[model samples]
Structures are given as C-alpha cells and as structure tokens.
Target: MNDNLYEIFHNVYEYKDKDTNNHFLLTENLAPGNKVYDEKLIRIQNREFRTWNPFKSKLAAAIKCNLKHFAFCENSIVLYLGAATGTTASHISDICRRGMVYCVEFSSYAMQSLVSVCEKRTNMIPILADARKVEEYLAIGKVDIIYQDVAQPDQIRILKINSQAFLKSGGIAYLCLKARSVDVRKSNSRIFKEATQELEKDFEILEKIDISRYEKDHMFYVLRYG
Candidate 1:
C-alpha cells in the first residue's frame, strides 16, 4: 500500500487508487486496534485509514456524489442534528480535531450509542435533545456549521430553526432531505424543489447532490447562511 496515494482532507484521507471505494475518511487511530461501525482500517507510518462507508453515512455518500463544498474546518464548531449513533459525527469530529461537534440526538437508545462514541472522541459532545428545541443546549455557543439528518416530515423546518438559533453568520449547513419523509404521495422532484424554495429565504444553496447510489430517496443540500 503506497501511503503517497492517500489524499488529505484535514484529518481525513482518501486513497487515489482503491478497489473497494474511491474516497475514504481516514483519522488517526484514536483508539488503537479498535474500529467504529465495522469500517476498514489501514495503518501506514503511524496513521490509520478508516473506510468511511457511504452506505452507512449520508455525508459520505454526498461526498461521493460530488459534493463541491466541505464546511468543516480546523476552526469549525458544528451543530449536528439527528446524529444517530454518531457514525458520521465521529468522522466530523475527526476532521474538526482542532474544533468541536455538538451532536444532538433525540432518541434515548441512539444517544446511548452516541455517548459511547463520545467517550472515545474528545471533540464530540453528545446531547440528548430534540433538534427543534435549540434552546435546550444553552452550553453550546454559535457554531460554524449546522448538519441535519432528521427523517421527519418537517425536516426542513427543524434545520431552519436550528440554523437560525445556532449557525453563525456566513456559516454553512448540510441538510439531508429524505423525500419520502416529506411527502410519500408527491414526486421526489417536487418535494426537493419545494423544500429548496422554503430554505431560500434564510440560506443560499451552495450545492445539491443526489445520494441515491448509497441512500435511496435522499438528497444533500449544502447551504450558506445569508
């Protein structure tokens, strides 16, 4: 394995030549000899590469689907809504090693798993609260990014509310729009267009990605706070 082939994205790494996948999110083995979500780990010169499974992570699938902008940076402070079990949150924490991720998950069961993930990752803070109620997390200050993946009919509303309360001016947000969740009866295209239009008032759509390859009926909307 040629380590030179691995491309760097903050703390993440993507191998240029790989049989299994095109892009991978690699992090320093925070827990030596341990794996999160049964992902593939490759160690080279004191660095470990975890296969960021797109099928398991909508953000990863969006990246694979040509997501043009990555808002997470070294100085980024993130508000992550619906961080179910911290699969993608773990990777976000990895990328924002110098920053932090406030992971909000409503389900008690999911929070249990997320808490476990937070135990190992110092950068991730697990909050067992509803995304709709941003005031619940008073400890969390303004954040550079807001990422939402809630599978609710009012998903766009949830994101808009959180973004308004938490997102800093000029901040970025990624909303994982589940078409079926919004309206099963309507066409996916119509739902996507309507949702995008709703968000235009508060956000500037940066990139729109179709992630059907890994997650069906899912669209990723990258937006910038206006």
Candidate 2:
C-alpha cells in the first residue's frame, strides 16, 4: 500500500488529508476527472480517488461504523435499487470497474440525473423502473450482489422480490432500511426488528450496523442470500 493510500477493501481506499487530519473513504475514480455529486477528488501517484461522504452515502456510513463484510470486487455484478442521482452507485461503479452496476430508480427526476452519470461510466446501467416490479428488470439476469436503499413501506418486500429474481445463490446484499419510511408511527427499534425478522426468512444476517449517526432512523444490514 502507498503511504498516502490504504486499502480498506478491494478497490476501496482510505485517504487522510494532511491539512485537516480528516480521513475519508475513497474509491479509485473509474471515470477519471469526472465529478459525481461534486465529491472531492484527490490525486496520488498518478491515480485519482473520490472521497465517499458518509452523510451522502449509507454504505460509506456503514464502513465508517466498522462494517465487516465488504463483498464488492472488480468483477462484481451489482443490482442497485433506489440509486438516486447515482451518488453511491457511482462509487460502486468505481469499485466494480470490470463488472456491471444495474441502477434502478423509480423517480423520473432522479432518473434524469442517473442517466447522465451512467453515460459517463460504461459499467453502470441505468434502469428507469420501480424496484418492486422485478419483472421489468429480469433481463439483467442473476447478479452477484443486490444493494437496496428504497425508502418505501414495503422495502423488505421489494428486496425479497428482487433477490429472488436476480440475486445469485450465496450472493451478498447491502440493505439500507429506513425505519421512518416503513412506519413513522412505530419506534425505530420495532421497525428494525420486524424488518430483520422478515429478511432472516430469506437471507442470513451477516452484519447489522445502526447508522443513525449518519442517517437517522436507518439500519444498515449485510446479508448473504442462500
């Protein structure tokens, strides 16, 4: 590892700014010189790294909170649900440079931005469709990972449906569950518990991280689909 860069996971690097003494989670820029969501970029040894903000990305928050399972690889085929404006999805595109990131978004407003981001990165495929309707994206085939960040009341059901449709056996999934979206009336703990129970029926819970510090009323789950 270079002195300025530390490999936290495959293609994921940690960069500490010398000026502010602030450490940042970074991914090698797959599309060099291109700004995704206006994230800061750094150059070291002729390589570019994009600072992944935890506040803007739940996966970055999970990593900052010590998430153990890092399943993304250079060749990972990812199905990213709720890829709003391609913020987190862009980072995954950097990590999985040799693979594919199928970005699904329901909102036309968000999809417009996602499409521009996809145009720059060849690995990311933007899909304008609802995540709950898996049949629309069945052409993507089985994927190595399913990343769901949808904020609907039936978020778990959406994940289950997509997992059954596209997730490969023993594949990994990163679920960013928004408790308030599930049930604003119920407590966050109660919503998390119920969601976990529902997920346990289809996936083995590998690691669970409470990311309320970065994203309020949200629970980040790393699971293995069997």
Q: Score each candidate by Cα lDDT.
A: 0.84, 0.93
Runs in model 1 with CA error above 4 Å? 1-4, 16-25
Q: Model 2: runs farther than 4 Å from truth?
A: none
Cα TM-score of candidate 2: 0.98
TM-score of 1: 0.93
Return the clash pairs for model 2, or none: none
TM-scores of the candidates are: 0.93, 0.98
Steric clash count of candidate 1: 1
Report residue 17 deviation for candidate 2 (angstroms). Answer: 1.7
Highest-scoring model, lDDT: 2
Worst 10 residues of 1 by lDDT: 1-10
- Per-residue lDDT tens digits of candidate 2, residues 1-226? 5686789899999987788988889999998999989799888888888999999999999999999999998999999999999999999999999999999999999999999999999899999999988899899999999999999999999999899899999999999999989988999999989888999999999999999999999999999998
Kindly give the stretch of ten consecutive residues in candidate 2 with the minimal lDDT sum: 1-10
Q: lDDT tens digits, residues 1-226, model 1?
A: 4654454456666665456545455665565665668888777766766778889999888877777798788768999999999889888887888789999999999999889889887788999998878789967989999999999999988988887788889999999999999999999999999998998988999999999889999989999996
